[model samples]
Target chain A: MKLLTLNFLTCAIKTCKTNPASFPLHPRDAELEIQEADLNLTFLKNILPRLMWEELRVISSELGLPELPATPPAPADLVEPSNTPLDTAEVTLAEGGAEAQEVEETPSQTAKDLHRILLETCIQEGKLVCGSCGHEYAVKEGVANFLLPGHLV
Target chain B: MLPTPSTSHVCFDRVYEPAEDSYLLLDTLSSPSETSFLQDRFKHANSSPPLVLEVGVGSGVVLAFVAANTQSIFGRQDTLTLGTDINSFACRAASQTVRDAIKERENGRSVFLDVVNGDLGSAIRPHSIDVFIFNPPYVPAELPDLSRHEYYNTIAEGKKATSFQQDSYLLQLSYAGGEDGMVVTNRMLEQVPEILSDERGVAYVLLCAQNKPEVVKARIRDWGSGWNAETVGSSGNKAGWEKLVIVRIWKSAD
Candidate 1:
C-alpha cells in the first residue's frame, strides 16, 4: 500500500507539470472551442462579411450546437421569444419551490447539455483557452488550470 | 489599355499591365470609375484642405490625386499632405513622383506634400494630422514549399540581396494574421489612440480578405469601453474573391 501511494503521488505531480491547463487539447477540438468562445452576436454581425455561414453551421454542429437555420432569422425574430410564460406568483415561488420544476429546468438543462458537450467533447479531450483573452491552455490528465500572473489578473 | 474584368460587386476601372510577378493588381485610380469610387467619398465629405496622411503610399497614386485635388480646391496649392511607406524603393519613387508633378504644374503651385520612409505615424508630428488612409497588405502566408514569382517579390530582401538592404515595406505592411489571423491587426488597432489627434475626422483603414474588418472589430471590442470604432464603409475588392471594407475610428477627447 505504501509503494502504491507513492507511485500515485509521483504520477499526480507529473500530471501537474505536463498539464499546465494553458495548452489546447486536440487541435481541431480546441479550434471549435476557440470559435465558440470567440463567436457571438457582435462577432457574428461584424464577421458576417468574412464568414461562410455554411461552414460555420457545419462546425457548430460538429461541436454539438444544432446547425443554425439555413437563412438568417428575420429582424423581428432576432431574439426568439420565450414560449413559456409563468405567472408572476408562480415564477417568484418557483425560485423557492420544487413543484412543476421540470419545465423551469429545461433551459438550464439545455445549457448544461451544451456545456457538457463543450467540456466533454470539445474541451475534455480538447483544449480550454483563457476565455477572457483567447489564450490557449495546455492540458494534463484532464485538468486545465489557467491561473495567470497577478499583473495579468 | 482595355478595361480589366472585375469580379462581382468590385468596381475598379483601370487594371495595370501585369507586373513582372503576373498578379493583376488594379491601380484603383488609373481609370475613371475607380478614381470616382475613391473621389466620391472625399467629395461627399466636402471638407476643405483636410489634413491628410497616407500610410503605405506605394507608388504615390493616391497622393498624386489628393495633391492635384487640393491644388484645384485651394486655387494656389497651399495644402498640407504627407505620404509614408516602409519600402525605400516606394519612398524614392513617391518623392520623384511629387517632384515631377510639381514641375509639370504651371507656376505658383501651392500644394505641399512630403514623403517619409518609415512606419505609420512615426515621421509625422503628433496631433498634427487629420485624415489617415491605409490600404494594408492582407495576404496570408504561403506554405514552405510554394515558390512563385509573386512570393519572391513579396519576400523582404535580406542582407545577402545587397550590401545594405533594409526590410521591404510590403513585408512590413503584410501579415498572416495572428496564429489564427488577428495578431498583427490587433497591434495596429492599439496604435489608433496614439494616431488620432481630434475627434472630428475619422481614421480610415481599408482591410481586405477575411481579416480586415472582422479582426478589427473583434480587437476593438476586446479593448473595452474607452474607445469607439465603427465600420463606416465598405466596397468590393478589384478581385471579386474578397470584399474590402473601410473602417473609421475616433478617440474621444476626455
Candidate 2:
C-alpha cells in the first residue's frame, strides 16, 4: 500500500473511531519498494493542503525512509524559479515583462521528492498497528487487510 | 460515453463480474446531469483534491471509470480514488483494475490509492471522503456465512492456489444481501454521515427494487436538515429482478 493511502485510513475497530490516536496507523516490519511513474506537478500541489505533515513525517520515520519536511510544501514551492529548463513556452515575448507572460512553471526537485515519497514508495508487506487499541492490520503483496476478527467486529 | 474499465483479467470465480448494476453506475456518473453536479461541486482548483472512496469495489469497474475520467466527471485531474472490499480476492483484483485504468489514460488521469480488505467503510477516517460510491450487495438473498472468512480469504500455507470451496465463498461475499437486501447497505449508510467531508461530500449508491429505494431515500433525507437524497439515474426496467437505480445523496445549504 502507498503511504498516501495511510492518510485516509484509521483503526477499523468501532471504539477507535473517536480516539485521537487511532489515526496515522504506524507501520512495522515494512518492506518498501519504489515504482516510478510520471509526476504531475498540479496533482502534487493540489494534494498538499489535505496532507497531515506531522503524521506523514511520523509514518516516514517509522518506515525508515528519509525525513519529510516539517511543514507541507506550498504550491509555489513545487515549481522551479522563472528560468525553467523545460519551459513549454520557450518563445516568450520577453519585452521587459510586457504584461508579465504566463509560462508553465517547471516542477522542482521538491515536487519529485514528494511524489517519490508518497506515490512511488510502496509497502510490499507490513503490519499497521493502531495507536489507540494496538490492533494490527496486515499488509500482504501491497494490499492491506483491515478486516478485524468477528469478536472484534 | 465513457468506456467501461476492463476487468477481463479478474477471476470471476472469486470476484464479482461487472453487471447491469455496475453499468448503471457508469451511466449515471457519466451522464451530463450527474457530471455537471460533480464538476460544479469540485470546481475549486486550490482546494485539496477531492477524495473518492468506493466500498465493495468488486472488479473495480466503477472506481476505475471515475479515476480514469476524473476530468470529465469531477472537473479536476487531481481527484484521489480509494477502494475497499470485504472479500480479499476482490480487493486485490480491484487494485489492479483501477491501476490499469489510470495507466491507460495519458492525460487528465487521477491518483489511485490501494484497495484494502475491510467491511464497508469501516477503515476510512472520519470526515475524509469527498465523493463516495458503492455498488452494494443489493440482492435479496441470505447473506453468506462469514465463519470461514479467515480460512477462505487466503491461500493455504505453502499452497499456491485456493480451493474451489474458497472461491465459492469469496464470490458469495460480492452479492447475497440479507433480508430485503438492506442488510449490508444499511450498515454502509450508517457510516456515510460520519465518513463524508463536512462541506462537499456526496455519495452515489446503487439499489435494486427490493431494497425499497423510496424508504431508503426517505431515511437518508431524515439524516438531518439539508440532507438530501434523490434518484439521479435509473435503468427504468421494472420487469426484471435487477431493476436498479442510482441514488445520489448529499447535503446542501437551505
Candidate 3:
C-alpha cells in the first residue's frame, strides 16, 4: 500500500509539472459558469444551498474566480488568498427582486432554467458542471466530464 | 424514359430493371424531401464540374439523373463519378444503366461510374474523393424478421429472432438501434468526422424521418462542431408516411 501510494504521488507530481491548470478552465471555468448567465444576485442567493460549497471553492480558486465571497459575511479585511476554497457558507445577504419571486413561485422551473443556462454557457464557453448534481464537471475537448465514481454514490 | 421490352437476351442497357421491392426503395430515395441536401451543396460550392461519389447505389436512378444534368450543362468539361453498392446485382444493374445512358447520348458519352463493392470507407482511395453521398437504410424501430427482401437483410443475415432482445441488438451490425431510434445514426455520425473530407468538401447524407428528426438533429448538432450542416431538399413517399431528408454538411474555416 505504501509503495502504491508512493508511485501514485510521483506520477501526480510529474503530471502537475507537465500539464498544470495554468491553462483556461483550470478551475473557475466549471463552477463560475452560473455567474456568466445574465443572472441576478437572487440566483446566487437561492442556488448557494444546492452546491457543495467546499468543492465550489476549490474550483473557483483554481480558476481564479473573483467576485465570489470568501465567507458568509464576506469580511472587509479578508484578503483574497492566492486561492480560496469552496467551503465558504452558502448564506449571503439577499438581493430582493422579481427573480426572487419567480424562484418562490416556480422553484423547479427556476432550477431548470438556471441549470440550462449554466450548461449552455459551460459547454459553449468552456464552462463545466454536472447536469444533475451541480458538481463541477470539467470540460475538455468540448466534452463535459460527468463521471461519478462508485464511492461517491 | 420508357422501359424497353426484353431484347437480345441481354440486359446490356438496364443496370436495374427494378423489381417491385427495389422500385419502391428507389422511389423512397428519389422522391422530393423537405430538406433538400443538394441546395446546401450548391450553396457552399456551386462549381458544376465537382467530383461526386454515391455509395450504396441502388437502382442507379439518382446517378443517371445527376449525370445527365451535369453532361447537359458542362457540355464536355471534366467530371468524375463513382457508385458502389454492397450487392453485386445492384452494381451490375448500375453499370448497365450507365451503359444505356451513354448509348442514348441523351445524357452524354464517356460518362462512366467508378463503381465497386465493399464496406463503407473501404474500396475508396483516401482524400482522392470530393463529395461523398449516402442514402443509408433507415427503417425505424424494426424487429429482426426473416424477410430476405428487407434492406437490413442485404447488410447481414443468420441472426435468430431471440437474439434481438440481447444487449448486442444495436451491435447487430444490420439495423435496430436499441429502443431509441438514434443508435445507428449515432454510430454513423461518429464516423463522419473521419471518413468525410475536411479541406474542401462535405458529405451529403439522406435519411428517412420516422418521427425522430429532433433526435437526429440533436445528434447531428452534437457531433457536428467544426462542420456546418443544413437541410437542402426533401421529398415524401406515401408508404410508411416516410419523409426523406437530405443533409449536407461542410467544414467551416472557423
Candidate 4:
C-alpha cells in the first residue's frame, strides 16, 4: 500500500465509523521502498488541491520525509500553469551557481518533493493501528488486510 | 481502453482474465453519452475529486479505463480510482494492469489507483463512493461450489494437495455464482446503499441472463426506497447465445 491510500482509510469497525480517533491510522514499523516513477508535473499539480494537507504532512513526517508547508498553497495557484519560466529559471540558476536563484525555485522544487513523497514511496510491509480502536491491520506483501472478523462485519 | 489479458503479468493465469463481459462493461462506460452524463454529474455536484471504485477488479482493465477517461475530462488529479478483489493474485494483477494502462496513455494525467484485497467493498467507507463499478461472478454453480468455507479449507490443505486441487479452488472462487448466478451479485447489491454517495451517486454493474436482470433490478429498487435501475446496454454472443446485460443504478430525487 502507498502512503497516499492511507490518507483516505480509517478504522473499518462499525462502532468506530463516527469516532474522531478512527482515522489517519498510525503506521508502526513501516518498511519503505522508493521506486522511481516518471515525474509528471501536470499530475502532481492536479492532485495537490484534493490532498488532505495536514494529514499528508503528518504521514510524510512519520515516514521521515522533509516537512510539507503547514498549509497547502491556494488551489488556484496550483491548477493554473505558472508563467514563471520554471525550467528556464532552473537552468539560469544552475549556471549562476545555485545560491543566487535558490528562492525563486522553491515552489517547483517543493512540488517535486511532494510528488516523490506521495507517489514514489510505497509501504512494503507494516501494521496500521487504529487511533481509536487500537485494531492492527497488517500489510503483507504490499497489500493491507483490512477485513474485520465476522462479528465486526 | 481495456488492456488485453496478454498485457497482464504472467502469474495472472489464475486471475480472471478480461473476457467478453469485461469488454461489454468497458464499452458501456466509454459510450459518449455515459461519459458526458458522468462529466455533467460531477460538474454539477462541484464535489471534491470524485471517488470511483470497482468491486472485483479482476485484471483492473475496467477501472483503468474509467480512471483514464475521467481524468482526461474532469481534469482532477485527485480523483481516487480504487479496486477491490477477494483474490490476492487478482489484486496484484490489477495493480500491474493499472500501471501498464497509465503508461500507455498519451495524456500525463496521474490517477491515484489503489487496489485492496477484500470482499466486495467491505474495506471501503459508507456513503463515500461517487461512482461504483462491479463485474461480479455471475456464472451459475452448485451449492458446494459456492461455499467459501469449503474453498478456504481446500486452500489450507493446498500445501499437501496437488496443483490441480489449488487451481480448482481458485477457479471456483472466481467463477462459481451459486444458484441463479446472483449469489455474489446480490451480496454486492445489498451494499450499494451503504457505499454509494447519498446524492447523485451511480453504479454500473454487469449482469447476465442467468442472473435474472429483472430480479436484480427489483432487489436494487427494494434496497433503497427511491433507487431505480435501468438497462443501459446488452449484447448477445452468437456461439452460445450468452447474453450480457449492463445495469445502471442510482437514487432518484422524486
TM-score per candidate, chains pooled: 0.41, 0.95, 0.42, 0.80
**lDDT string, candidate 2, A71-121, tens digits:** 888888898876564443344544344554666567898988999998999
Residue by residue across A1-153, what tens digits does model 1's lDDT show?
Answer: 000001001111112223323121112253332212211122122222322345334445545666566853332232223634555356758677655453322223333333233222333235333212454433322222222223432
Ten consecutive residues with minimal summed lDDT in candidate 4 chain A? A98-107
lDDT of 3: 0.40
How many steric overlaps are in each model, in order? Answer: 14, 0, 21, 0
Q: Pick the candidate with the highest TM-score.
A: 2
lDDT of 4 by residue, A32-143 (tens): 8886666655455555655778887887788787888888865334433554567657767778855565333233656656667777788889888888889988777787
In the range B80-150, model 3's lDDT, one tens digit per residue, is 45665544345555645654554555333333433443334332333334566666545556534322222
lDDT of 2 by residue, B172-243 (tens): 778888999889899999999999999999999999999999999999999899999999999999788778
In model 1, what lDDT does residue B155 have? 29
Which candidate should be chosen as best, given lDDT against the real structure?
Answer: 2
DockQ (C-alpha based) per candidate is 0.01, 0.76, 0.01, 0.28
Could you give candidate 1's per-residue lDDT for residues B185-238 as a string of tens digits?
454555555555553444666565566566666666565554566655545445
Give me the runs in candidate 2 sitting further than 4 Å from their true place: A83-90, A94-103
- Lowest lDDT sum, 10 consecutive residues, model 3 chain B, at B5-14
**Full-model lDDT, candidate 2:** 0.90
Lowest lDDT 10-residue stretch of candidate 3 chain A:
A1-10
Q: Which has the greatest DockQ? A: 2
- Put the candidates in lDDT order, highest first: 2, 4, 1, 3
